[model samples]
Target: MSRVRQILDMNAFDAATGGDGAVKRRLDNLGAASVLFYREPIEMVAARGAWMEARDGTRYLDFYNNVPSVGHSHPEVVAAISAQVARLNTNTRYLVEIVDDYLEALKAKLPVDLSNVVMTCSGSEANDLAIRVARAVSGRHGLIVTDTAYHGNTALVTEASPSALRRSPLPDHVVTVPAPGEAAYGGEDIAGGLRAAVVAAMQTLEARGHGIAAFLADSIFSSDGIFADPAGFLQPAVKTVQAAGGLYIADEVQPGFGRTGDAFWGYERHGLAPDIVTMGKPMGNGFPMAGMAARPEHLAMFCEDVGYFNTFGGNPVAAAAGRAVLRVIAAEGLQENARRVGAHLKAGLAQIAAGSDRVTAVRGAGLFLGVDLGAQDGSGAPDADYTVQVIDRMRDARVLIGAAGQFGATLKVRPPLCLSMAEAERFLEAFAGAVSD
Candidate 1:
């Protein structure tokens, strides 16, 4: 058998459990279960620019992970981390120039008013802190989020997450709105659905006689389909949230820092400024660092009374790594690369879709894109079964991407911002072959 197939076959067995079906059986025993139920695994051993080498040394183009934003093992980021660790890697309690220096550089990227910063160990913690600050400032207990959004797997976050929200039970104070599909969720009326979802949330709140804390959402709904219809989709929703006594929180874990091409933040493409912005994933370029950026006043309540202090939140090593990433993004013009390379890939995919029946259309902005397959009625959505088969075939073709959508039907194509047009063409060739097969 071929190497990829061999690895796929091995995925059914639990290496630790020592038997076929053992992993599934054990997971079933746990009683809490929710997975797309795909049966292939890519055992990654090494990573470089825009690719991952399997344990068997098989190469594959990477287009489904946003965590390694700049590129895997970027020399500058690695060097900065190494140099910092050689001197110091202490906690937030200590006064350090690296911490403040890193803050200054990061704050420079945003609008001047969005100055104050607080660090967290991960995106989930960043989100949690954002929520706390918003609640403290606004003095509201209720929260809001779009349906099918995936913030994190934390207790509070998951309750706000529509991706896995219905799978479990939690507080009713979270006002849920539909993600803009324009057909599936609320067909042909993107503006109406967005407005309706927010309006319905307000109605729900009034019925319960409650107020809202914050409207938390990804600037780009990564877990859902890549783009949620037209530009400025979330502007109406943000206005509704604020009017309903809530603050707007833009979750930048996936689409922040110019990955979305046209704007620095995915939400900016939608034409609204968030009150709070939570960042993670590429913030430290896989250094386990995340942070929240807010206006000075929102932080004032928490900074004095609650007092934010994290053990390793803004440590010297993590701060240095972050500084390096910001520098590289500007110096290397990666955000512009995302624009050029993503446009090339989008054009190629559209050209191919015109010629083939396999792919229906390409959706999303910049490197953050989705490939939807043709349906029987000429609709673009590839059913979950076909999406699984396509992703499986692509993996066999030595390309590594993943499935998104409520049922895992959308082929997620968010590669690192450093991906070049040559690599994009290479990916398109492999993808074409996979579809033809």
Candidate 2:
């Protein structure tokens, strides 16, 4: 199926929107490429911390959106953005204290060596810049990404994203490596598997005359079904890439900003220091702000050869928003909250899986959890159709969730970091009911 068609078909969309008018208008304007969530889509007008209020006044516990890391429409983030925008909004051509301050604060949270940053407007831009820099610095054109990984949505990045290329063949310069799934490993070394995959991919790329430029992967493997276990398993892969003269770029757009609870960045969980790190989505809460951090020495070659600059990147307003998100994360101790509430949520999911024959496995760390939905016949095979039903059912119960994995059979339950214990319980209750249904 096409990437856009994999989400919702026309009949389903028509039924969800209650008529053909909204669908027709969208198809007329946005064309057939627009993707929306849920069988019965909710028209959300407003949202707050961990909850979204629809146009009809229905409230839903949001467990899908990580963009609002701190919370939806957070007062502090709003105030910061408002204060900065009202005062001044301009390019990064001139010196700005807030921009430098934000960069310093972000650096403090990252690895000590990743001191240099190049800000962008989105994760796609960040990844694009990272890839460009890696290729320029390494003087190679080959890239390696996970089989079902999704980095972002740009011309260059789309080729790197296997999830977006579902039915299509990847480009010549790109190599797809298998993502490590728990079920795939039978007492095998996880790190070894990752290293082997990278080695094989690099060999293929070299044979194709596209020497390895970079091995880019989301540290959490979000689109490859959220494989975050066996901490430090990615260290071997990082070493393999670096030893082969390829840069290891950590796409932390999904796993950054303390969502993992254990560490600030997902790569930190695996005890691996990436050559370059890209962050977005939750960086400035809802604001459009993202950036790529790298070792100054590694990025210096690219800067000297093909000097880079962005117009709206790291502006005062975005800096203010980013600073607010960092402040809120530290002040509210949301990382601790994710650790506690994520554990509670995972335990509750385990309890539900214990009761249901259809639930095959529960995986992931912190606020990012994936529930494997199995066939109804007790065969334990991935059941994408059944997973879709459960997602729609959860939506009916006013809980927002999503699916991931190659077959889209894993329930992607990554709620906001601020999810409370009560909210986690509520989600568990709803999820248990959905599984039974």
Model 2 lDDT at residue 127: 99
- In candidate 2, stretches whose alpha carbon ends up further than 4 angstroms from where it belongs are 1-23
In terms of lDDT, model 2 sits at: 0.87
Q: Candidate 1 deviates by what RMSD?
A: 5.1
TM-score of each: 0.89, 0.95
* Count of steric clashes across candidates, in order: 4, 0
Per-residue alpha-carbon lDDT of candidate 2 for residues 224-288, written as tens digits (9 for 90 to 100) = 77898888889988898999899999999999999988988999999987999999999999999
Candidate lDDT values, in order: 0.77, 0.87
Judging by lDDT against the true structure, name the best candidate.
2
TM-score leader:
2
